[model samples]
Target chain A: MKNTYTDSGAKDTRSGFGAGLLELGRRNDRVVALCADLTGSLKMDGFKKAFPERFFQVGIAEANMMGIAAGLTIGGFIPFTGTFANFSTGRVYDQIRQSIAYSHKNVKICASHAGLTLGEDGATHQILEDIGLMRMLPGMVVINPCDYNQTKAATLAIAEHYGPVYLRFGRPKWPNFTPEDQTFEIGKAITLVEGKDVSIFATGHMVWMALQAQKLLADRGIEAEIINIHTIKPIDREAILNSVAKTGCAVTAEEHNRYGGLGDAVAQVILTAHPVPQEYVAVNDSFGESGKPEELLAKYGLTPENIAAAAVRVMERKKH
Target chain B: MSITKDIKELEAWLPQVRRDIVRMVHAVQSGHPGGSLGCTEFFVALFQYIMDHDPKKFTMDGRDQDIFFLSNGHITPVYYSVLARSGFFPIEELRTFRRINSRLQGHPATHEGLPGIRVATGSLGQGLSVALGAALAKKLNGDLHTVFTLQGDGELQEGQIWEAAMFAAHHKVDNILVTIDRNNRQIDGDVSDVMDLGDLKAKFEAFGWLVAECENGNNLIEIADALLLAKSLTRNEKPVVLIMHTEMGHGVDFMMGSHEWHGIAPNDEQLQRALEQNPETLGDY
Candidate 1:
């Protein structure tokens, strides 16, 4: 069945998280929010304003904040920790691994300002390895929703889920395309546009780029299947396998590094399930530096044209 | 002195607990025994007297009960032995410590569905914050029950402890007790030489905790009294801490006065000599 989507506008995904957290506070009294000195940046100020008592300002101590969030779960409080992606995973991976994931504590680690799109702030704050780090954990649920509406829905949705989760979002105000009241099913991939020629799988901000790539490929008489694989861990294997089985080739795109991001995840699915030719449109093995978001995306072969190029290359690899 | 009889019974249990610590580590040929032996009286006093808990059901929520968290998970021997003896689980389970598929992991973890552990700890400096969170939960629930946790003196070197310390003081998580096992010994050597936790009491005091020092943490009466005193100071809108001065190895002669035994499991001869020092008060597991 073919599916279609239309972009409403551009909005930051972090604002979506903020909106969802505020809703969660109203819906469930047990929902608590903790921020590590980046409430404004993470857009968690709304939840803080709405529920001051439940909001905890942990003041840049990400490790302690993670431990505290893990502890709160024992008392039936669903704690959502907000911080930059760098601090969330690389800074306090041990805490998340031990206190939350290993213990199986119900902590929602909400990370904002992920990937090279966290432009101008440079490499220190921009973290592209978060998805890989989080997905590698034993029981952590890693999510990188495409836009504002889906991110908000994911935020609210994970609160109802009863385990540790890592929700990753970006700093840039990207395109908002998903439906407003859509039900977010964890571990389910979303097919934004349906086609039969070559499957183009993407996540996070790259979904928008993939959509543009789909249009560009269509002009050149290529019917590309563009899918949003938001939930990286516990990946939607059925969706991936079915798509690759039909298309016989695939192209994966993401704003993260080429090695451990969506490409690797999709490659594993393809090799095990379908054994198809696949090309990746992601940042090669490298660290991002100071540049504008658009410049960084183009410099690292993450633009819509690049995705279309990969789709063309992968289509050629598919032997009829 | 109404608990004089109780104190006598608790004091009598220390030898067997020490025996359990040395033997549990010796059997596994791994685990920390020095700090375990040193903190024997503290555990005995906590489970037996100071803290109000039910090992019978061992509910993690601990709604009406005092909960104890072992922050320094290396000393799981004393924790496991006391937990077993206190009837949180079968004393027979002590045999399977660090064994394959055993509930008793090398570090205390809830992943194996261990009853006493509320959070996984082996990584130092995280437990105090967890304790504070539990205490905050207690406050939120209006449970009025206290939350307790134990940490090694060396564990204070981690920055998270101080962050948690600031959180506790800034938030005034009053209904909590943190006892630092001040054996002054860590894996590398004395904590002072290893990292120099200069003036620990002053540090906690500077962080705004109502600090109390117990010069004799190995004394059951002293532990019970200090904890009782800390309890009285709780809910006054300030946190409380007990800087307990304990030996690295209290009951054993050779293991004491050295950091060598801090983590090393005693050999058969060493275990026998160590067991001979305490001489089986309530019998081994």
Candidate 2:
């Protein structure tokens, strides 16, 4: 649960996606890539350099890129499309809905600069609602890995999975705490700590914060159960139900809007099985602005302290 | 072998297609008949002789076979009829046209598990991009088969169509052929007065596509020649665009040249009158 390795360095999940995509290019000839004018930002330069013929520069047109990706599926090519989270969702939702999601194409939509942590390009660029938007579409797999290693594994896994997948990652460097060799599994949650007082469910960059909060809660004699839910849709209902049944309370945290995202996805699972007191640590119906990633997390109430506070509040709400 | 035999065969089957259109539209009480009747000859030519396609082993990766996409999906009645007549599905399923649980929807969709449809396309201006995408995919996969698509002239007004046009040309997507249904009519009005797609052929050429013109889409000989020319124009590098001039209501004299009947389903009386114009080509479905 702790960042025990002192030499551990932080790396952006987008870099992980780029690295994974490069590996895929080397291994699979059918793994073609498309970028909506953000090759360097999405860390797709490695793939582009290695397989120049397979890489398509789609300019700034995300809609066209999505349709093209759908078309590529017909010819049995697995296409990985990269862009900012905002453009990946908002600018091309209809195209994705009709061409990719509806057609059930094997297209990997790799999104970067997710949540308020994207920092500085303001509310327009920092997309906190991408998970909500993508998860709403039926037959679309949604994944938000916690760290670099998990993200790379997810990028590789989604390429092999034969269907539409939205892989959401971020721009900032998070604490690289997950084991480097762990394989990514869809619809499964990774339990980081065991507790009985309350369950703290989180995903994406928020998983790192939830881990920090676990330490803080432990110091306060609060044994908080922490589960990292990388896959948002096809949520780990079994893990959530089991954890909440033991803890009798839960605190959900994510670097996303409170209405939808990991917190909402977790709450739905908990609500259907065992009704329990739940507190959410997420953006409270407000758009993000230009700031440092850590600062934005703090401002948006998604920091470790905020999650710890939410856990305490939920634990208090738990009646014997 | 002879034009007389071809016309006799067409003349025999054209009425059945017409009756199928009317009966299907009447049975469902929904669907665009004008365009279906309008584009019959073109559809007949493609299915009967021109296209090297088979419904049995439908694959999105048409490596060895030609592919066709319906960009203007409102003409589903025609597409569904031709597809059924050509053996993509049991012609009996035609009775369920636009019915719930039927593969035949108001617009063509792949969701119904329709064999020949690769992508679900009801919204205009999207199929062209998908076709271009498929075409590009074919080239990347070393596929020798060509891709084909038909779009309504009014559909050209969509910004996505222009985007696709630019994309196909910029990428030199030469393994695909695109045909514009230059029927000059849309749901709202005549294409020219509605939104004037001025000089579409020139615009396509400007976009760097090899261009062809079909004077009469209903003329089997002309359509066959145009498709052949378009095929020859496809050089595995530059996409082919053909401006197919078609009457919105070709066989049905009462429905031609006016936007009023563009999407209006013919009533029982109108349907009967329309049927009298063309003799039963193939047996009535």
Candidate 3:
């Protein structure tokens, strides 16, 4: 109905993970932290410094770190493992699949510096396929919070959740648009702006871009309904169906590849329930190169302009 | 938790366990028997004497108790036999090995509700890290009990083992005791030929682990003594790994030291030959 979501300030989501982890350590003694030699990069130094004995520096061994995290659950401790998203999921998929996902271990896989936003590190460090990889695993709860406050909320949220959880966040200071004190509900879509002309479903860093696109579209007289789909797996099917039914067309946006990310998740949900014309604003099937975060986002067509353009294209394809 | 110096009990127990290994694999006709037979004595020693676990109440969370993890899960036949005979499940269930809906998965799995298996293992080089995590959790919860994991000598080829090795040393997760089933044979051929693991003892020592070796891994007495020694070395600011030397398929005259038998189940005539060598003592499952 109204665009009420506003930017509180620019804060990196990785900091939220660190702050939430520190709080969790103080709140619960069973909360343990493990890192594969990138504690500072992932913003896990707070937890590590607070709980030294409880913290384990896994020393560049992500696969082993994952296994040890899975094992820690057997002794009744909730272990949050920290590393870049590239190493977190793709580097150690088999270990995560066998030791954690298959056994249903209560392990939190905290991945920072996800997507093209990682910047400068190039294609090797950026992990665009993590959402697809994690969501494909059976019984894994995948959450990619948009802003600092939501990331912190999601961090604290996953600790309370049992079984395997993949919490994806990123570096770089972006628009902190979500409510500061809002509780993060996994698998429930958060509607930031509501309009009838188009349904804009976005996740991760792209959520801010969608909000920006909502404004530009509003000026052009095309009201866009922007919904943030944080939890990708166990996707909010009802929310997607209802929003698309009203709008009659949809645009899915993400910092991930269009092949198997938010676009695919929404397509599966809407295609099954309310098949509608849908356009995607995401990374095409290709690798990214070293560049600034803003440049990479623009070069990869992951910006507000691209989102708005996709909305227009999808609306044109709508059945009259 | 102390291994009775009664070499007679383990000696009497070995033939039956060996029989179970071959019989289980032969029944499936599609499981690894070489490593299983090679590590028979080690499994018998761990389940019967090493770990402080109750089979009657097999829980995934083996709290305040010594737990064993088979990192090299291809050797499931021996693990199943040892777990069953140790009372983890009905020994008769061994008859259902690798069958439809059987808890005895081709590899160890937790989803089947199998007891004594805290984590599903078979994908190599993960067990050590999982055992370390369990050990760390025990420390957080103040669990004085220890954790044990077995890795195949061949399985050490997976890069994760080295990673886990580094983590164990740096973090001082001393509550875990990792035993390497040093049967120098993998699926392809000799481990040296497939991927040369140059001086494993030296490698572990360099990784900051308290390393030891059993002169003969398949020897019950040697395995029992080395395991007890490894147990005593825990809580010493370092993890312990026992590199026990074993043949690929020990005891079976035709299979010993041969990688060809690594995953092959004996034919009917070969099964008869294998059974004839070891006298059945504890009775068949």
Candidate 4:
């Protein structure tokens, strides 16, 4: 299981989004991109340069960008809006709810710099609660892909999916491990490693942490299964139930808040059907400050060591 | 669908439309009839005369056809009446306004699969941006159709509207015609008393939009001509906006000229008088 996956390289997930968007620009003429003055940061410059007529630079207005994205759907065009996670969800919640989510528009809200991985921008820019806000909306597909290849695949996959979607990614260059040609499914969880001792469900950047934690648990003779739960809403319940049925305990890992992220989403699925012992390796109820990405992950208990500890703790609870 | 240029034929629908506005609100005992009556002629002009649209062939993707968006969605009595009378949906559905399990929600919505409403909008300052987006789509597809949006004078206070206003002018979104229902009234009070929108014509002009004004929005000929003028102003590398000045309650004498009737429905006797004021030319729902 340890030799099953390897890091292809280190690349920012936003670049994957840019790459996917550029591909979508050529593949689908109806695909349009709109950025709120963060073209370079969101890595949408490639798509903008390639399809200048289709790219809309909406200055710094997030709410207007959301409404415009919703509007663009009315004319049979799939509009992908680019901005930071904070501005994408919080600043334009009403606009997204009324225009995009409620109206059931085909708009992909691609948000980069999600969670504490946004690093030095601090809590205002690094939104840990965007997943909660977006997943709470009815008919909104919330996706947080793991790596550059996965992010690019998810970007292309979401364009084919009709309806409102909130595609969240990070800024820092992390381990790009997923296969380049991987077929990204919206709600299907990918089982990265097979084991029966305990299930380690992870999403976004935490999937890498979970894999590292798997190695640590394996060294301790605790075989852990790693499943990447990318789509938060319309979560892969069948995959979760099947995995947890084999492994009596679970550990949910994510860079988001513990209250309403993948942990809670998994908890609800477990609590309703298969009752199991679980522990959350996520940001506890608190705001994050500016720091290095690795330092923030360590400070917030989001590293592989914390995930392994959480898995061990959950396994302990399962023993009783 | 042919555009109705006859002001007499368009005006005939006005009295019945106004009747429907007051009656629908009176039946529900809730809804904004003041702005509904105020924008009667404007809706009639757009749906009946001005816009090149097909109500019978309504699609969510209104490709190759002019589309209208109601930004100030509270005045659904007028919107629903105009849409119903224009044959977007059955006129009988007008009875379901604001009712439980009704396609017609309190605000216009696309959630219920309602025809003629492309977006859900009770939230102010959002519709203009959506309309601009549609306009951009038309340009991208090389579709010669125009997108239209109507906003409340009070809705301009919303920050997103200014954001959209600036973006439309800056991008030279020349395929859109935005109309402001300058009814001078909001739910709280008169728009002037609540928040002063000083010199809107000059403000829009400063935003780089070609601005036109219709002094009497209740008059069919005036609104129709103004809409035609606004249409003529399009394709000139600039977005066009029509500043339509109208009384809050235009037809109903008792409800006229006051902000008190902005959201409150007329009582039974008041409804009778309102209907009496505008004799029913077309049958009511």
lDDT of candidates 1 onward, in order: 0.90, 0.85, 0.89, 0.93
Candidate 4 chain B weakest ten by summed lDDT: B1-10
Which ten residues in a row are the worst by lDDT in model 4 chain A?
A1-10
Candidate 2: TM of chain A? 0.97
Ranking by DockQ: 4, 3, 1, 2
Fnat per candidate: 0.70, 0.65, 0.93, 0.89
Q: Answer with 3 or 4, whichever has the higher DockQ.
A: 4
Clashing pairs in 1: none
User: Candidate 1 local accuracy as lDDT?
Assistant: 0.90
* Better TM-score candidate (1, 2): 1
lDDT of 3 by residue, A191-295 (tens): 888899999999988999999999989999999999999999889998999999999999999999888899999999888888999998989998888999999
Among these predictions, the greatest DockQ belongs to 4
My TM-score estimates for the predictions, one after another, are 0.98, 0.96, 0.97, 0.98
- Candidate 4 lDDT over A294-317, as tens digits, reads 999999999999999999999889
Docking class of 4: high
> Can you tell me the DockQ of model 2?
0.72
Residue lDDT tens for model 1, B1-285: 466677887878899999898989999899988999999999999888977778887776777888988899889999999999998898999999999989999889998887888999999988998888888878777788889999999999999999999999998889999999998999999988999999888888899999988999988998888878877888888899989999988999999999999888988999889888887877677
Q: Which lDDT tens digits does candidate 4 get at residues B35-67? A: 999999999989988889999999998998999
Clashing pairs in 2: B12-B281, B12-B282, B13-B281, B13-B282, B14-B281, B15-B281, B174-B238
